[model samples]
Target: MSINIDIRLKKACKIFREGENISGLILLQTNSDVKHDGIFLTMEGAVNLQLSSKTVGIFEAFYNSVKPIQLVQYTVEVVPAGKIPSGKTEIPFELPLKPRGNKSLYETYHGVFVNIQYMLRCDIKRSFLAKGVSKSLEFIVEDRRPVKKTDREQSKAVSFRIKPESLQNTRDKSNVPRFCISGKIDSLSCRLSDPLIGEVVIESCETVIKSVELQLVRVETCGCAEGYSRDATEIQNIQVGEGNVCTGLAIPIYMVFPRLFTCPTLSTSNFKVEFEVNLIVVFEDDYLVTENFPIILTRH
Candidate 1:
């Protein structure tokens, strides 16, 4: 006889927050009567950090590995089965998802070098010598932090000024060589679905600007005592200006943050996720100028 298993949540929504209760039902189907020792279900959730060494050194490459740092994990038994002689059977369950003390749940994130995920898994126990049925589902955990209102006077515009002479010796010189790009974001906070409005001004007579683009970058930091690594991904890129842009020129920038690829800023003891607006300017001389402005994202 063939066996099938299905999971259904009471809310029918996979999205949940901290301190929330997850209630669901497990459905089992069989073509004919079957006997089993017992039935058990397990639910596990945690943050997995996988790191790799990009260096060509043999020792460094050999040490690279995937390290799963657990944020929270819990398991429970579902049912004690005796015998099954039915076409369909249902098992109900409830699980509590709680964040650590004074800690918040981070939004689900995925990147080339890093990923933060939360998943629920269900396993069915079968007799020995037979493979057990298993299934897993991914969910989103969002943290809703209280945002302090900004004063009317301080909400005008947030400006970013980058100068080549003021850069420190440890800074990467290849990004900002001989040009200054100053920009202003309309506000310091924005919703994930809202559009970000800003303006940029380029000032440099020696360098000929070839193109200017705006990028929505997500910076994910993950580690725990062993070592820490941070990676940034350009989620969205928009061309705002092109051609010779020198001798004082202004460009207007507008970009909409997508909900699928973007997440609100969050921080935990194990990891943190942050978002920023980056302005990249390429000059004819092959030099580049990058200016970044930090912005907070909220759920609408």
Candidate 2:
């Protein structure tokens, strides 16, 4: 006979805070009566790190540095060895969200080189002659506390003017197209719950403006005392202007931080997660001018 298994969370969104309990149910459906050894449920959270291609060979000797760190793990038997009738059966379960030993629960983040994840797994043990069935479900974890008022009050807005002369890494200044752009970010320190707010204006340009885009980037660092691997990757890109024709027109800047892909600015002994924003202006000839801003993210 065949058995179908599914896992559902109490919260439709499957999001939990640091100290909240993870409550869910397991649904089992079978065409006929089935016998099982037992039903087991396990909750696990971990932080996985990997070295970039450029740093992989360098850390080959210290492979453990990139090993996954277990933050939490709990397993319990939900049902004793018994027989279940045909049709559907629901088994409820609740697991406390607590860190193991001295480890602390960090916000769930999905990045290129670093990832924090929490999963719930259910296993149905069967006889030696029969195959066992299992299922896994993922959930999100967020910080319990918000950013302090002091930190928010201290946040300062930053203004900048981007011109050919202001651009960096240009081998020849004369070759760069003449352009003038100005913008002001409301604040360099931003809350994870709110959208990033800013405004930009195109003052003048010698060449036709092709596109204006805002790129959110994530900087992940992982390593130990011997060495460290740091990499920056783009998380999302939003186009604010396309085929720009008018000059001196203000363009609003707004971007929502995507969950699971971003977390509060974090720095630990083993790893660090930071963020940055790049304002890019592309010309008709494909030449682009970029201005970068390092931003601090908070839980508030």
Candidate 3:
């Protein structure tokens, strides 16, 4: 006989804010009647961290520092020791979404090296002779606090100009191509729900422009008093311009922050999550020039 288990959330989006209630149902189906023990449902949230190859050796000495951090954990018995009827049976459940004691709930984030996740699991126990069944469903958690007016008022727009003289870490200034790029970001503080807005103009260039692109980067740091490992990785790259054409035309910069892959900037004693944006200009010769802008992300 075959048994199947499915978990469905009342909210189709499967997204809940902090302090909210996670309401869902557990559906069990089996071809034939089966005797079992008890049915259990668990809700868990955690932050997992892993060091990159280069940083692994440094952290190997302090392995326990990188262990998964349990933010929340709760288990409840959905059904007492009994037999699940054949055909189909539905069990409804409601779990309060809160952090354990002194711990806090962070937004759900899926990243390399560092990840924060929330999940719901259902387990069906059977007799010693029978096989057990279990299922897990992932959900997203968002911060519930509102953005303060002071923070919003502090947001400021940034204007920048990029030229060879402005470049950093340039080995030979003579070999560097001549180019003048100017742009303005609407604001350094960005709301998660809004798109990053900006515009760039290529005023003059000695070489043909091949492409202009935008790169979103995530900087994650994990460590302890012994040491710390910080890694920066690209989250997404978008092409805003292609081919050598008008020199003075303004190019618009627009990018919607990808969900799950990004969350509000976070910092704690154990770790931190930050974001940055890079404007890249590629020449016909494949030589590239890049300008970096650190940004603060928030959910207002």
**Clash totals for all candidate models:** 0, 0, 0
Once fitted onto the true fold, the runs of candidate 2 whose alpha carbons sit more than 4 angstroms away are 146-154
Q: Candidate 1 on 15-118: residue-level lDDT in tens?
A: 77777888888888998877775666555555565443542243342233345545556667676666666799888888888754554456666665456677
* Cα TM-score per model: 0.73, 0.95, 0.97
The candidate 2 region of ten consecutive residues with least summed lDDT is 145-154
What is each predicted model's overall lDDT from 0 to 1? 0.70, 0.90, 0.90
Error of 2 at 208 (Å): 1.6
Model 3 quality (TM-score): 0.97
**Candidate 3, which segments miss by more than 4 Å at Cα?**
148-154
- Candidates by TM-score, descending order: 3, 2, 1
What C-alpha lDDT, on a 0 to 100 scale, does residue 108 get in candidate 2? Answer: 93
Model 3 lDDT per residue over 175-217, tens place = 9998899988888788889999999999999999999999999
Per-residue lDDT tens digits for candidate 2, residues 1-300, read 888999999999999887788888899999999999999999999999988889867765448778888998988999999987899999998988888998888899999999999999999999999999999999999876667665576478889999889888898999988889998999888888999999999999998999999999999999988888889999999999999758999999999999889998888878899999999998998989999998888887
